[model samples]
Target: MRFMTTSDKPENATGGESAADDTAEVTGIAAQDWDRASADPQYRAAVVDLLGALAYGELAAFERLAEDAKLAPTLVDKAELAKMAAAEFHHFERLAGRLTEIGEEPTRAMEPFVDALDGFHKQTAPSDWLEGLVKAYVGDSIASDFYREVAAHLDSDTRGLVLAVLDDTGHAGFAVEKVRAAIDEDPRVGGRLALWARRLMGEALSQSQRVVADRDALSTMLVGGVADGFDLAEVGRMFSRITEAHTKRMAALGLAA
Candidate 1:
C-alpha cells in the first residue's frame, strides 16, 4: 500500500486553472474554492471516499466510546466518556450532511469502509477501563493525524471542514490524565498499557492498509502523479510525523511508545 504526505509548499493547479476552479468543475458543489476543487473527477471521488471513511470512523468511535463508558470505574468518568461519544456522533452527522450536499448518498459512501473499521474495533477491543482510555487517546490521535495530512491536499473550504471535524474534543487530555493517574497508582500498569498501545497501533495499521488497498480512487488522489500530487518521499515524511505525534501522546500518558 502507498501513503501520501502533505507538501509544505502550496498545491499547484491541475492545468493552467486554479485549484478552486478545478474543484468547482469536478464536484459541482457551490461552496468555496476548496469546495470547488471537489469537482475534479478524481478529487471528487477521493473526497467522497474521504468523507465516507471519516463519517463511518466517527460513528464507530461513538459506539466504541459508549461501550467503554460502561467500564468506567466512576460515574464521573462514565459521563465524560458518554459526552465524548456524543461528540463523535455529532461529527458523523456533519460529515454525512456534507456527503449529501455533494450529491452522494451518505450511507453508500460509508458502506465500503464499514468492514475494515469494524474489523479494527473487533481486533483491538479494550479489556479494561484503563486500556479503553489509552485506545481513546492514542488510536484517535493517529487517525486524526492521518486525516489532517490528507486535508493539506484539499482546497481551502474542504480543508477547513476536514480540520474542523478532526479537532480534539478534550478527550485526549482526559484520557491522558486518567491513564497517567492510573499508572502512578500502580507502576506495573505502565508496562502492560505500553504493550497494549503497541498492539492497538498494529491493529489500526492493518485495517488502514485494507482500506487503502480497497479504495483506489482515494489512494490515487493522494499519490497519483496528477497535478498537486504527493510523492512517496512526502508520504514517508507524513508517516514519520504521525509516529512522532503518537510517541508524544504515549509519553503524555506516562507510557512508552
Candidate 2:
C-alpha cells in the first residue's frame, strides 16, 4: 500500500480506501508537502506509511490508556495512568507537527489504518490493572520495537522523532505492584495471568500480520527491504527482551514469573 501524505482527504484520494465508502471526500485542509520523501513516490509512500501508522497508533493508544486508567485501584494510581496516557497525545502533537510541516493533515494521514489499528484496541480492551499492564508492557514493547526498525531507515531528524517515543516505564512500577498484590491475594491468579498474557500475544501477533500486509512500505522498512525478511529470529529476540523485563518486574512484585 503506497501511502502519500495528503492534507486533502487521503482515504478519499481515489475512493479505494474502505473509508471512502462513507464519505465521497475526506474534506479537510488543502494538501501540502509534508514529507521529505516527496522526490520519489516509493520514498514518500514509505515515510507516509511510517508516519501514518505512528500517528494513528499514538492517537489510539492514548485513548485506550486513558480509558484503562479507570481500572486503577486508587486515585493516585489513576492519575499516574492519566499522566502516561497524556504522553501519547504529546507524541501525537509532535507527529502532527511534522505532518503539517510537510503539508498533510494529521487526521487525513491517519485515516488509512483507522480500522485495523483501532480494531486491535477495541478487541483487546483491558478489564483491570493486570490487563492494563499487559496492554502497556506487551503492547508498548512491540510497538517501540517496530518503530525502531523503521526509524533506522530514515534521516536522523525523522528517526530521532520516532525513537523518542520508545517504550516508557512511566507506570510500570505501579502496575507491577498492583499485579503482584492481586496475585498474592489469590495465588491462582498466576495461572490466569499467564494465560491472559498468551492471549495478548496471540491477538497482538494477529494484528501485526494485518499491519505488515496492509502497508508494504512499512514491511520493507522493518525487514530491510524484504516483505517477510524479518523472521522468527528477530521476533523471538523482541519476545525474549520483553519477557525478561516482565519477569524482573514480576519478581519485584513478589510474583513468580
Candidate 3:
C-alpha cells in the first residue's frame, strides 16, 4: 500500500481561485438559464441523463445507508446514519421532481441507470462497520466530485440543482471520525480498510465511465461536442483531481492512500 505524507496532500482539487471566472468565460452554457439551454435537443438529452443518474444514485445511497446502519456499533452511530439516509432520500426527491418538471417520467429516466448503479453496490458491499463507513466516505465523495466537474459546464439553472443535490449529507465528518477511531484502536485495521477503499475507487470510477459511455448524448456533451464541454485533456485532469481528493480523504482517515 502507498502511504501519503504531509507533502503529498496537494492543493484543493476544485480548481484554484480563478476557476469560477474561467468557467464563466469558457463555457457559454454556464451563464444561460435552463429554458434557453434546453432548446438544444442534445443538451436536453444530456441533462435528462445526468439527472436520472443522480436521482438513482441518491436513492441508492439512502437504501445503502439504511442497511449499513444495522452494523453500527452504537445507537449514536446508527442514528447518524439514519439521518444521513433521510437526507439522501430528500435529495432523490428533488432530482425526481426536476425530471418531472422537465416533462420526463422519473421512472423512465432512472430506469437506464438502475442496473449499473445496483451492480456497483453489489460489487462493493462492505464486509463490516468500518468498511461501510469507508465506502460511504470514499465512494460517495468520488461520485460527488465527478458531478461537480460536470456541473461546471452545465447551464446556470441545472448547475444550481446538480450542485445542491450533491451536497454532503453529513457523512463526511461522521465517517472520518468513526474510521479514524477504529484505526487508532487497532492499527492493523488501517491496511485492510485502505485496500477496501482502493477497490471502491476502481469500481466507482469504472461505473462512472460506463454510465457516460453508454449514453451517447451524455458522452457527447462531456467530450466537447456540446458548448465548450470538456476536451480529452480536461477529462484527464478531472480524473486526476478526483484521485487527489481521494488521497486526501484517505489521509484524513489516517489510512494510506
Q: Which candidate should be chosen as best, given lDDT against the real structure?
A: 3
lDDT of each: 0.79, 0.64, 0.80
The digit string of per-residue lDDT tens for model 1 on 92-209 reads 9999998888899999999999999999999999999999988988878998999877876665676788899998888988988888888999999999999999999988888887
Give the distance in Å from residue 174's predicted Cα in candidate 2 to where it truly belongs: 2.9
Candidate 3 segments whose C-alpha is farther than 4 A from its true place: 1-27, 226-230
For model 2, residues 193-251, the per-residue Cα lDDT tens digits are: 77676677678778877977888666654443332244445445545665676556545
Tens-place lDDT per residue, model 3, 157-235, is 9989999998878899889888888889999999999899989988987887888778988776665343344457656
**Higher-ranked by TM-score: 1 or 2:** 1
User: Which candidate order results from sorting by lDDT in descending order?
Assistant: 3, 1, 2
| Model 1 root-mean-square deviation | 4.3
TM-score of 1: 0.88
lDDT, model 1, position 37: 59
Comparing 2 with 3 on lDDT, the higher-scoring candidate is: 3
Look at candidate 1 and give me any clashing residue pairs: 23-36, 23-37, 23-39, 24-36, 26-39, 26-40, 27-38, 27-39
For all predicted structures, in order, the TM-scores are: 0.88, 0.73, 0.87
TM-score of 3: 0.87
**Count of steric clashes across candidates, in order:** 8, 4, 0
